[model samples]
Target: MKSAILAVVLAMPPQAILAEDVPTTVAHPRPVISEIVTADPARARRFPGVIEGENVATLGFLTGGRLASVPVEAGDQVMQGDTLATLDQVTLQQDLASARAALETVQAKATLAAQQFARAETLRARGVASDAMLDNARANRDAIAAKVKNARASLTRAEDAAQYSTLTAPTEGIVLSVLAEPGATVSAGSAVIKLAAPTGREAVIDVPEAFAALLPPDAVFSLRRDKNDTAATTARLSVIEPVAETSLGTRRLRLALDNPPKDYRIGSLVEASYATVSAPLMTLPRVAIAIAEGPNGPGVWRIEGADRRAHFIAVTLGNTIGDRVVIRDGIAVGDEIVTRGAHALTENQNVGDRLE
Candidate 1:
């Protein structure tokens, strides 16, 4: 009976062997993707930029002195001739007092000299004084007269110096900065305050010299706050710097804002958009194109054949407008182009199974 049981077990297949021989279905999940068709359209070019005032002036004292008091602070609105600060006028006052005293002394001396000259002229008329004595008296009077004039000039100059102790605003604008504080000693012409006229704000942007030829004279531009999604302020191109800013590898372009915001301050960052060119061209989302090695060189992916399989298509790229790029050639309107999931696609790949 044992021998018969052994023979039956050999005739039947082992359980492990049967399990390994079983067949099963392997399922692959298709990737989800979104796509758009190539269409000919015009798009604008958005460039990063910054806001700036048309007129920015640094306020400072004409004479060097200790800053006695600063009445205005940063962000203070000021008008032309408004007192911004005052310097210690102790020395200036003393100089003016001395000048006045000197003028008085010179005037008194001039009066005495005039009386002596008259006396000398009378003596000469009576033949008691010689011509030389009369001439001496007249010369002394003239010398004293010149001294009085010099003293008066000195007084005027001293008074003018005293007036310089007060720092005044140059234009109607807001104070952007206050460099000197009370008791701070500043040198002559040292910047003590920064003024900016927001009413004359301009949008300044830097563009590469290579692309400068594409820009037009008096082109319209749009400017908005950096990282902002709000509507931009319209401006017109007014200046193109003759020399390129080598440090930035770009040329400066200035635009005059039509109506600036009341709260728009100077030195605020902004983004600028310039319409370089407008032409009928096929544009597609940046993601729709996939770079791959082809028989010639770099190529993009496109749906080909009724099966809509991904195929490598060679194309020449043009300028990029926002998130879309212009395909110079190789793509046409109504052409179904993959926008997403194109990075993983290869030639002959079945896009029908691709997920959107």
Candidate 2:
């Protein structure tokens, strides 16, 4: 029976055998979007900024009164302790006198109460005064002493107000604006003069939330007065506003100038740009990167030269600059990388010829 079956199979035509064979899946070299890896400095993002004082101040009195005189004007340079403005002294003096008289009255009353309290204690020791009488005398003395203390505090405050009536430069600075005029009645804490301190000047720039979010810690900025790039100088990020400006959705960045020019004065219009600190790093578009399918994860599809195959290589990502991201590792300069359809690619997939 076995010989008979073998003879019948051999007699079958070659076309019949070939037709019944299992088919094979064909994988063609896939066309890919790619970019040649190159190391270059990051594109700088420019912003408009202004030079401002380190700690600007608005001068005002602690107590409200009619302004007698304003000795300084906008753009005037004043030294520490220089008089900026003064309030009418008559009201302050009258208040001081009232405080003094009140204190004197309370002190006199306290003295009389002390004498009564002492006499009451003596009488009580002699068995001539009742315990209730001694207690009452002590209470009266305590109450009068408290009033004296309160009056003295009032007197001290009055004296302080006398000095507060005169507004003086707390520090050497240039007056930026005059808020109040002479003879104008102003309330306590009302702005009288705007003063910009001589030191702690910085560049004030509004950075969008997206850029500020990716701002590197060591990032430096180049500043130029107006549009003159010829006179550019460097600065370091010093401070950022905790809150974003509501209207523009941006944060205020304060960049401390490095050896700023003398012409970089207060309110100077300037332009700022971010500068990279380290050596030029490799960059790739967002589409070139993929998550997972890599041994270390968050990798890209790298195309090898000899085989022309795409392989998954995990990379360390640096700061995201604009649309491209910096690749810290896992690939070197001159390596071709897939920029599109990376996430859908499998390991060792044959990629078509490099589109140089």
Candidate 3:
């Protein structure tokens, strides 16, 4: 009876619960981890931009007139004082001629008055004329002199008006647009031509308000068409507008391109980068971060023991630098951090095939 009781007890499933937990000795693949170290950080900011000339102007007529001849067309290169257009000058010419004739007549009268005054003075000196008579001659001479001055001034004004009938380039530049054609009437101060100075080009970019504050006054820039090629040229920060544009909520920044490309055209779209801030930072592969259940909440992968098993460590992450993130407090330098296969790991999970 005693032997049978011992056998029954032995057969009753060993009296201990065998928990089927994941084997700690199972050689699962370990994740590759890179040590976090302090290094120079790259400071970068991107902004949209367009190429533009330094000087741009809209040329206009100074006087109202019917356009008779437009000597230059759009895209025409002009020099200072080059004729751009001509107005109907027949009326102006007639007025100038009438003014000159009137001026000539006034000058003849003034000359006769001067001669009469001289004769009256000579007669008074010889006691042949009364003082009152001499005074009358002097007054007549002064009146004619005033008439002559007025006529000459009128002639000068008429000449200037005639000159205004012709349009000339104010400065050397490329003609970008022609508003009025031949036979079209243009009013004074109406834009007739668009001129762009060819000295150098400037790029205007709108920087986001967040990045604008971090940008340095003298930050360097590289301008390029694509990422594969080297930058065609470099630019320096020239202007930082004080006011932010209401529509874009961004600040305006101007960069002066040194030796701008020949293919650069006004209004051409461009990509620009502004180095805002830089500092030493720790970096790791993006795969090192993992979200797993922990005592508090979700956590990341961290090695704890000599076996390099993964530990679900809670981390407070900071700014991301490229593929890596800044760890605020969770992990430290010399800590073995799993970089890959982190998602498949669990707390206290044994791992094998450890990688450097």
Candidate 4:
């Protein structure tokens, strides 16, 4: 009987099939990349930096004098002991002459006193001079000798001042900046030029106060000349400035770069990247963060329970590290946060299992 009915239905035909005859397809939940909320992944935090010499020396004069000539300009590479600047040579020479004359006069007086003391000693031995007279002559000779010694010391100091009129490079390096010029009255120990040594180069970056505490010591930093540069250099954390910048609240950090390429010269602007092992705050991909409406700022879709329902969670945002941003408050560790395909998700929507 079933065969006869099937044959009759097949004969009934081409236009006889009804639209309701088709089976209804069941809709499954949407699949998403529900990544676990944790500390920032090993993505390095990149900071714009400038290359600087580690052994930076502030060159200045030893004697306060009118700057006669500043021969070397900024960016000039100089050798150790090379003349960088000079004070007034005429004034230095005059000072030396004055000191020499003073010394000569003192020496003449000392010689005359010695002769008088010897004559007094001879008279005292012959009973012609009294004991008090011999004592007076000896005291005069001693006082004159002391004056001569003081005058000689002053002459030596004057000679030194003459030599100090010339300011020379203390080490082999490039002149970073020239602060003083000719005819400028500069005091002793006043900086005239800034010099950076040829070696011990480093990278300097001003990190935001938000990430200052999270920075690890001796952390390796990837350095590059430009943002689109493919070739890069590396540096390690050397030191950090204790004081924060008053306006921006950023602390300066220095990283040691060993044997960097020739392009990594001092004052060259470069980008520095450092991957932190443990970030102070948890971070999520910017793609996962959604701008909330009204009082709520930014937020992320977090999945909960075995049912795999996504809930819109409001999060306070901090600094942005690359494509990721810091979550100052919002989610906790081990929370399932949707990293991919998060835009279309609704409140309490059932998202499918984590996508590979």
Instruction: Quote each prediction's TM-score.
Output: 0.53, 0.70, 0.49, 0.60
Off by over 4 Å in 4: 1-46, 60-65, 119-135, 163-165, 184-190, 230-232, 242-249, 258-261, 276-356
lDDT leader = 2
Better of 1 and 3 by lDDT: 1
lDDT measured at residue 93 in model 4 versus the true structure, 0 to 100: 84
* Error of model 1, residue 233, in angstroms: 4.4
Ranking by lDDT: 2, 4, 1, 3
The residue pairs found clashing in candidate 1 are 31-355, 32-355, 33-355, 33-356
lDDT of 1 by residue, 65-183 (tens): 77889888877889999999888889678878999999999999999999999999999999999999999999999999999999999898778768889988877998878988988
Which segments of candidate 3 are over 4 A away from where they belong? 1-48, 55-82, 115-133, 157-172, 177-194, 206-214, 222-234, 241-251, 275-356
Supply the TM-score for candidate 4.
Answer: 0.60
TM-score leader = 2
lDDT for each residue of candidate 3 in 267-299, tens digit (9 for 90 to 100) = 667777754334323455667777654455534
Clashing pairs in 3: none
Better of 3 and 4 by lDDT: 4
Tens digit per residue, CA lDDT, model 4, 67-158: 99988988889999999999998877887899999999999999999999999999999999999999999999999999999999988877
What global local distance difference test value does model 1 have?
0.76
Q: Is candidate 1 or candidate 2 better by lDDT?
A: 2
* Residue-wise C-alpha lDDT for candidate 2, range 1-356, written one tens digit per residue: 99999999999999877777967678889888898897653336689989988889987998787899998888788999999999989988998999999999999999999999999999999999999999999999999999999999999988987878889999899998999988899988999999998877899999886667666655689998766468789999887788998899898999988889998888889999887656556789987889983367798888986879988888999877678887988898888889987877888899877666
Clashes of 1: 4
